[model samples]
Target: MRHAIGLKIGPVAFRVGSDWAGPIAALADLYRDYPPPTGVPDYTVRLEAARPWRRWIRPSVTVRGDHMLPDALPLDLAHGVLAAEIGMNLQLALGERRWLLLHASSVERDGRALIMSGESGSGKSTLAAVLATRGWRLMGDEFALIDLATGAARAFPRATSLKNGAIDEMLRHVPDARFGAALTGTPKGRLRHLRPDAQAIARMDAPAIPALILFPQFGRPEAAEAMGPAETFVRLTQASTNYVPLGRAGYDALTRLVTAVPTVAVDYPDTDTAVGMVEQLWAALP
Candidate 1:
């Protein structure tokens, strides 16, 4: 570990070490506003060169961490920031157990959380990002932390990864927003990272009760429908990364969430329309 940086995103902390200095430097600049990680980190992520010579001859960053995929591929050095972000996310997805990690984005208003879960290209991230710009506090854009005991939604506000058309859309919405270099030709295709707003970074310790859950789908006609608890529970089980690993705790927490929170499946054609729809749905909440 030649170069390293420690970061604390809400309840979790990570000490990331890299063989090259580039990734660490990039991480420092991007996460400049985050609170410094304290004590021993919750997990460790190593960004290492695939081979000794490869560090200089076309560097490749291999994400080796606390928990890993046996056959995961290494990323090119040019995508060091992406590699580092991936490394951190990989650790949480494979290692976290204290809190239920949902593959979703979240925002908050009046101490109530709005959680959106969907598959990739479902525009959850973009919707959360746009919502954040309009008075909503961005809780997270990748993973939402669901507390096991309280079922509260904790903040995990990392830099939001904007891909494809989303990059241009955000650029238009926030012309002066902090954005990382656009890394093209990556696995996810034409990606960029948008730093979270200052309020979100500064108040990362706050947690909110889950008031609403949305299964949002993009590239569709506008519509909204209530989801039964049974269907919501099943969909969330699929969305969760550590549901089975947590056993009874996960099961109980998830059941409570699905039954208590008003879950809805929403469809929309664009961010603007989705924003209006979201406001309507949230306002309808008790």
Candidate 2:
């Protein structure tokens, strides 16, 4: 841990340390606009060589922090940026308790938030990134933080992780300066990190009411369906990382969210169609 950087994204603060300066430098550049934590960081992520000898020969980064998966595999030095990102996510997923965390992507418009959650291949991240560029505020792409007391969605707008074709699509719309280098050979295939716009970073502290909950699936025939409250509750419980641990507080927060927000399931073959469908849905919101 020779080099380190502290960053505050929304309400969470993280201190990322690395044995090598490369990862730390990359993070500093990417999160340059973000502010430092007010005081002590909420979490600390360490990137170190798996073994002391490995530091000099064929170095690899082992993600270590307050919460870690013992069996988690190390990443090559080239992918250290991604390793750092994953490390921060690990700490939040395992340790955060102040907010009800949802494994989803979120965007906001006119004080209303849209929450999109689905399986691995779902287009939530890509969709959120696209919407952010089209006048919507990017709340977050990895984890959507929900205030347990007010039922509002707070911004956690970290870099948007774009995978496979989504990266190229985003490149077509966004400028080069907004993207990280294309990361190849990732476990999830070709990936790139898209930095949220300055507007998103500037308004990171603003919270929006949860107005829509969407379960989106890409590469499917275009269709939209209303979801029942029972099914939505079950699926959301699965989507949440610390739902059971939070017990009644988590349950009540989630219950209020599902009850208050409109839920929909969308299937689309392409991004344009999906965008159109989402626009139509938004227009019809009561």
The digit string of per-residue lDDT tens for model 2 on 132-160 reads 87899999998999899999999899988
Off by over 4 Å in 1: none
Which regions of candidate 2 are displaced past 4 Å? none
Q: Which ten residues in a row have the lowest lDDT in candidate 2?
A: 29-38
Q: What is the lDDT of every predicted structure here? A: 0.92, 0.91
The lDDT, on a scale of 0 to 1, for candidate 1 is 0.92
Pairs with backbone N, CA or C atoms under 3 Å apart (clashes), candidate 2: none
For all predicted structures, in order, the TM-scores are 0.98, 0.98
Considering every candidate listed, which one attains the maximal lDDT? 1
- lDDT at residue 156 of model 2 (Cα atoms): 90
Overall local distance difference test of candidate 2: 0.91
lDDT of 1 at 141: 92
